[model samples]
Target: MDVVAFKQFINDQIQLFAEKLGDAKHSSNDGVSLGKLTFYLAVRQSIDKKASEQDMGLVGAFNDTLQALGMVEPGKTFMSKLDT
Candidate 1:
């Protein structure tokens, strides 16, 4: 995909991450834990969504963002996947 589309995807996923995080941020119940889990899963899903595509470069980028956000370790991801 073009840079614009790739950027849009990243932005959309970031928005989703923020929303999920908000659920935890605003909740006072045990659901806050669930929301945190949701945030992690959502972040992983976002990276996986881009990883399972034609953009190897984008997958690297998504993974970088994950690491930058402290959501995942860099080497922990994209290690076992087949090379394109």
Candidate 2:
């Protein structure tokens, strides 16, 4: 999928997650937590109305950060430099 489509997907997921979590970022009120992408809290947190922007920034940043540390490779990570 392209970035546009990818952002739509993430945004949709975020909306669903937000709804399930009651939009609770930090609290003990009661919720299912971050759900599937709990491991990607920061990434999930970075998500916003501007999903396309955030998505592209994150993917590029991840790629560069890993490359700088000599860890770039095809299908190396769940979130690679995916086009979308």
User: What does candidate 2's lDDT look like per residue over 1-84, in tens digits?
Assistant: 555665577667666666666655544633455543442334544443334564556655776777777777644653444565
lDDT of 1 by residue, 32-58 (tens): 555444444444444456333335555
Local distance difference test values of all predictions, in order = 0.54, 0.55
Total clashing residue pairs per candidate? 0, 0
Q: Which pairs, if any, clash in model 1?
A: none
Cα lDDT for residue 34, candidate 2: 59
Candidate 1 lDDT score at position 38? 46
lDDT of 2 at 74: 45
Best by TM-score: 2
Worst 10 residues of 1 by lDDT: 75-84
Weakest 10 consecutive residues of candidate 2 by summed lDDT: 35-44
